[model samples]
Target: MTVKLRVTQLAQLEMAALGGIGLLLLAAFFFQLVQGELPCAFCNLIRVCFMLLGSGLLLNRIYGINPWNYVLSGIGALIGSMLSLLFMFAKALPTTKPTGSAILGLHMYTWTFMIFTAALFFCLVMATLYAQRDSLESPGHALDARPTWHKGVIALFVALVFANLVSAFLQNGFDHFMAGGQQHYRMLYDGDVMKP
Candidate 1:
C-alpha cells in the first residue's frame, strides 16, 4: 500500500527543513565565533538569500501553503546559487586566497552552491505537489494548532534574522560597505568611518 502526505503534512515537513537550514546558519555563526573567521561580503549575501528563503517558508506556515511561497524561496535559492558560483570561481583563481578553512574537503561556498541548488529543486517539487492537491485544509490537523517545535522553529528563524542584521551592521558600519578581507570590524575601531 502507498501512502500520500496531506498538504498540511507536506507544509510541516517543509517548515522542518527550513528550520534545519536555520540551524545551519547557527552553525556557521558558531564557526565564526570559535574560529575567529569572519564571512566575506559574498558569504554574507548568500546568508541573506538563505534568510529570504526562510522567510518564504515562514509565510507558507503562517498563511497557508501557496505556489507563491515556493516561487519566493526558489528566487532566493537561484540568486544564492549564482552568488556562490561567483565566490567559488573567485576563490579558485590562482591569485586569490580561500576565505575560510574547508570543511570535509570542500569550501563553504561550494557547499552553499550545492545547498542552494538543492533548495531550488526542493521548492519546485513541493510547489508542484502542493498544486496537485485540491484541498487547502486537511481534516487531520487544524492549522491554528501548531506543535511546540513549530513555534521554536519560527522563533529561531526570527532570532537568526536579527542576528544577521546586527552582525552586518557591526562589520560594515552604518554605511554598509567594507572590504571583504578586512579582519576587524570597521565600525568598532574607525570612529570617522562610521559616518555616512
Candidate 2:
C-alpha cells in the first residue's frame, strides 16, 4: 500500500519547513546581537542563499509544488554549500577567525554547509515523491477554504524574512555590497562603521 500526502498536507509541511528556517535565521541574529558575534561577507552570502531557499519553499506553499520550486531550492543549497566550502579551505578571511560559536568542534559555516546539503537532499526526495502523485492541484485551492491560522503563520514567516533582508541591507550598505575581510555591521547606525 502506497501512502501519499494530500496537496494541503504537502503545502503545510513546506510552509513549516520555511518557518523553521526563519527561526534558525532568528537564532543566528540573536547570537549576533547578544553574543557579540559578527557575520562576515561570506556569512552574509550564506544568509542570502538561505533566504533564497526559503523563498522557493514559500512559492511551493503558495502555488503548490512544482519542479521549478525544487530546482530553485536546490540551487540555493548548492551555492550556500559552495560558499561554506570556500570559507572552510580557501582562507577567504585570513585575518579573522570563523565567526559565531562552534558546534561539536565544527565552525558554524561547516554546520551551514551540512544543513544546505541536507536541504538539497530533502528537496530531491520531495520532488521525486511529488512526481508520483496523480493529482497536481494547487495548494492554494485547499488553503482558500482552510482556517486563517495557517495564512497568519505564512505571513509571519514572510515578515521575518523581509526584516532579515532589511537588516542585511542596513548592515551591508545601500549598494548591498561588502568586500571580503572587511568589517561587519559597517552600515549600521547611519553608515557609521562599527568595530567588530
TM-score of each: 0.88, 0.80
Q: Which tens-of-lDDT digit does each residue in 1-196 have in candidate 1?
A: 1225465578678878789889879978986778877777887898999998888888888777767878899999999999999989888878888778788999899999999999999999888877876756443444458888888898899899999888888877776555476577666765554322
Residues 1-196, candidate 2: write the lDDT tens digits.
2244465566667767787778778877886778766566788789888888887887877777778989999899899989988878755467866556887888888888889988889788878878887556555655576458667766876887787777777676776455444445656554444544
Give the range of the ten consecutive residues with the poorest summed lDDT in model 2. 1-10
Count of backbone collisions in candidate 2: 0
lDDT values, one for every candidate = 0.81, 0.75
Instruction: Please give the clash total of every predicted structure, in order.
Output: 0, 0
At residue 71, candidate 2 shows an lDDT of 94
Q: Give model 2's TM-score versus the native structure.
A: 0.80
